[model samples]
Target: MYFLVMKMRSSRNILPLLSTMIQRTCKFSALPELTKDRYPNVKRGNYSQIDTKHLNFFKDLLGETRVITDENECLGYNTDWIKANRGYSRCVLKPKSTDEVAAILKFCNENLLAVCPQGGNTGLVGGSVPVFDEIVLSTSLMNRIISLDETSGVLTCEAGCILENLEKYLDEHRLIMPLDLGAKGSCQIGGNVSTNAGGLRLLRYGNLQGTVLGLEAVTANGQILDCMSTLKKDNTGFHLKHLFIGSEGSLGLVTKVSIQCPPKPKAVNLAFLGLESFDKILMVFKRCKHELGEILSSCEAIDADSLAATTDNLNLKSPLEKFPFYMVIETHGSDNGHDEEKLNRFLSSLMEDGTVEDGIATNEPSKMNAVWQLRERITEGLIHDGYVFKYDLSLPLENFYSLVGIMKERVGKDAVRVSGYGHVGDGNVHLNVAVKEFSADVLNKIEPFIYEYTSKLRGSISAEHGIGFRKTKYMHYSKSKEAIDLMKSIKKMMDPKGILNPYKVLPQ
Candidate 1:
């Protein structure tokens, strides 16, 4: 099927197609419904007293096959990928089309039933999962590529479409998504927009605010805001779509997304560099950024403990025999010869200056993936080894690596296993505190201890990850009172009833 999307340049309105077309289809409910089964194992309190009259209306409107209330069927949607936070719901609504979403929201608004929209549920912040037994409006059924314009380099798809599927589809067309993450296979486009996810590619492509052209969302009052325009320059009043980009589903449920695509690089190079001290690591980043210029896509760092975790737990061999810090640098460009020559020259210069202890990578894909796996698998492997207190913070390059030393000192050299790593170019670091087990007393001390030092460094407690329930209290440390008040005002304006993903991103 083909769709000729004529996007308006002056307004938020988007023209889908003059004629209807079939793209892709999945088996799931189209609206809300009720069933005989209840979520007995859910941690939240019972929702049996809540009226399902409006939910029943949408069930009849969407059809029984679309809405699911079976105990086994609803369990999968109840929890996110982390499984750290889980909630119960009597029904799971799977709306396929915008009209169905509108109808469901209208009924929900009338009945005053709490609603939580979820995507791939791979969120680390637990924003995609419910803390209460709210009706989960699962977007899984709405996976479909509505349209793609090669000329404009714009792609539009439904909210539930997985990130990996979008990458594959774009690859087939010789295009690529502007952003990518480790959970690309399971994370959905809508979730990415909701969280404003920052991945490895953010160094080159920037954040979701830059890549996302427009969005279509169903607000709390059942209003359909379609601003899926592909215009490169739109001087519209508010740019309302930005409101939902990082609002974490508290503002509205993202039904569809229109993103700007970048051309696939002709040549890509990845190298793993071992460094002795934090000072030299920053030197390497500076030299690479200046020398490689536009070809330098990313520069990520991994400390010794992270290296040990990945090597021991994930069984990934260490690239260097001994190094306090390791860096994964990537360069992508249109010309293979030019990119390779620039990268080699940069590394050669670094070697002469003693900035990089050891550097390796010959532009081979397999080897590159292997080097990246060291950083990517570290977090995943920590889950099996011990209880991890994860923190993603943004700090100055000078102050970044010192965190490792401070954390180890405070937590004790052996009592706590701390690792610091992340996209160095972006000044975002991912530090994991691995302890044998977790207890309330230990957690209370550990959480605030880390946050206090982080606040001293002027670093964010949660850099890319949104302030979900887990980190809501710590948000005050990062955000200003006025800024936070504005966010609360916006949330109140969009969801006056406070039924959309309540008790999240803000402290009551």
Candidate 2:
């Protein structure tokens, strides 16, 4: 299904067709089921258990080659990124500044020890791994960048950089990084500002709580709190870096950020559309926000079992020719002949009122990265199509894709696939569910019945993926027990020996 596309401008023909364009394993064939043995009532948080004098104080404060007590190099920081949580983390450490992550969180909060705070682990839910053996603390050697005002585009970096290497170092100062993802080549802008990561230009340079603008974190007693403010006007006091953006490292440990970057768009365009239902994908997203106004950026929404789970598990090909729903639409501008004459006068008014039924438009960048690798690699092809679960919702784009058709009829026929894709201009919908294997009666019919139909349509059961460790018991189905008891009294006042990241995002 050509997910949202457009390029028809004819009396006969006027040209608008251009196209072109990971065996990064672990979808678990075995050896995954260990997120504290698949959440057996989550226990184990008494802390302090790294032994050998706390591994000789993290091998004498990050030495012995940045510590990592081998177990096959700490099993890739105790696994994640769609292995469905398997953290064991027996020492990983690496630290490369920010005062060595505040001397390993003030010596793991005076040796109560728990830690976790990894980056580039590319978290999906099990927030940067490490559950029962918490002691990872990596930041991939705090990949610095530290500052690049570019006459006020603002950027600061660290917290192990790498979010497509700061978008190619802010594309040589033309600037960007107002967020965009599909795990930006291995994610990490301090885990995208501790999971405030809303990608694909967050429907035009938005979210990351308004593109960051400050951060420093490090709490659990090792104190570092600098609000790093690169300023977009800080009215000061009580913006305490919004207590670590999305708070998945549980109240602190971010280590440095400072965003607000957006300049790199001197005209770009793309369209890949075909639709039949979902009310023509909300009447072509309200005529692409009033006819590609301000050169829209990303709109994405896909279905057709999420592009047949990326052509039956990642072989990737689908360009156009199947319409049960799809839309990709994108645009960013500064003028390419007025952004291709406002995307060819908004695809000649959707081919004279056809609501973009079929199309393909491009401005070539390898044909717009071959149509954004068909919507950012459909979650690595639904984790190679099987036993996946995913979810990151946010709904209310008219009840967004209606819970992927009520989860394909409440997972009818015991699911081998019940799909959906995301960021339809920020209503966020990465809902997925595959299963050629692994099932506890289809994960008990999709958890809390899809968080009670997304809290009866109030919607937002972990939108940009943050109440980690697999949706921290659906966090009161989207908060409000006085906002989760004021987020557990600010995680017991900045991790009072809860020792950071333990059992993740509170809710225990």
Candidate 3:
């Protein structure tokens, strides 16, 4: 038996791609038409004034091949790693050079169209995602190492350069990027510079504020701030590039970075030590600083829970016979034997004085990575347990444990489980809470209390993660009212339209 199909035309006089009744009988029919009005439309946006002609103008400015409008190809650019924030842009623009970026920005500015600049999209915050369906300007194509000067220890690269590649490039030349992160493989240098990322090495190499000599960014007005210089000392009128660092792309789009690299150390040593109390952490740091001096490259802490989670997750042996508040200390030196001798002396003295509990030392590459994995993979295990409320905080190192104790008391046991770890030397502690669920009401009640306590202690709400959309509202507790107002005024002056990463660093 055969069925006769009847087609119906809608208000637009377009034939129904699939008849509701006919679609059921036949296995296949015509493909569903893309409902541009329903699916592709930007729900909340101020760029309605922008016309297709303007888009075409920019498309023509950049070659037609570089403009991507297909839905499949645009999916990757629309969302970031976490999948929390996302929007479907009309098109994705991939520019290969700074000139292309400038031209596109100029066209967007003239058309009054908002632009969303994207890097590796590995950001935990929603800064890289488009809240509105503005044109996504991707730096992925702009990745190119322009120069690397061994003598000056400076590496200049386009914003889209991958952090891991940069590290590899520097390694081949016996140099290193001053910053290193767990997400180094995926995060871009542009995002790093834009967020002013502080990572594990910050304790030794310092933050980007010191390592980044200069930066070049494209402002909302289509002007590029070309501050890419390797000058160690420049008494300029103002250190303008510093403003864009950690701005989360609110003021401008960073295009190129000229970062100061450090010479690679000849030797490195790793030690995993157990401690009974959090209070002993400060004492341990002091002793290490005094005894190890500049060789103390890293000082990180991990709680008992973190150790168990990491060991279980990675299927590795526990570094110690018993799990206690753990600290991983790393030392680097020009001479391997000298560094080892210093580390041995320090450990021996600590053991004799009962400052350090049980300890394990490793110079073996595999063993070193094993211990580092235990420290790095602690957060990854939280997902298996339950929902997580991750907090990257900076407080007095002494208050770390007591703060967790208070939180556990407030949130209640089993309902909330807290694990502690992070760069202890820098005072940035990763206080993660595991819960069954997190609702707006609970977050509303809990966040205020946490921020108030942190503020009372004269600590920052966010240490490494910048004030992106997630934590913008809590900025008041972290910064003074006057400081926030000045930041707003600066934002207004720099980006009059507030199109550059709107609703990101500033509270809505």
Per-residue lDDT of model 1, residues 438-482, tens digit only: 434545656777777778888888778787656776777888899
TM-score of each: 0.87, 0.37, 0.86
Instruction: Please write out the lDDT profile of model 3 over residues 1-508, one tens digit for every residue.
Output: 1111111121223221121221111111222222122223324546654467866876777778888888888877776543435566768888988888888777776666777788888776667866667788889888899998899999999999999999999999999888988778888999999988998888899999888999899888878789998887887799998998989888889999999999998887888887778777778898988999889889998888766655554454655644458888998789988888788878777767777766777677777777787776666555444455667789987776566777777776644457778898889988777664544454554677888999998998889878765677889988888999999999999888777776578765
lDDT of 3: 0.76
lDDT of 3 at 64: 85
- Tell me how many residue pairs clash in candidate 1: 2
Which is the better candidate, 1 or 2, if ranked by TM-score? 1
- Superposition error at 259 for model 2 (Å): 9.2
Model 1: residues with Cα > 4 Å off, grouped in runs: 1-55, 413-416
Cα lDDT computed for each candidate against the true fold? 0.76, 0.79, 0.76
Clashing pairs in 3: none
Q: Candidate 3 regions off by >4 Å?
A: 1-45, 49-55, 63-65, 70-73, 88-90, 314-317, 413-416, 436-438
Backbone clashes, each candidate: 2, 11, 0
- TM-score, prediction 1: 0.87
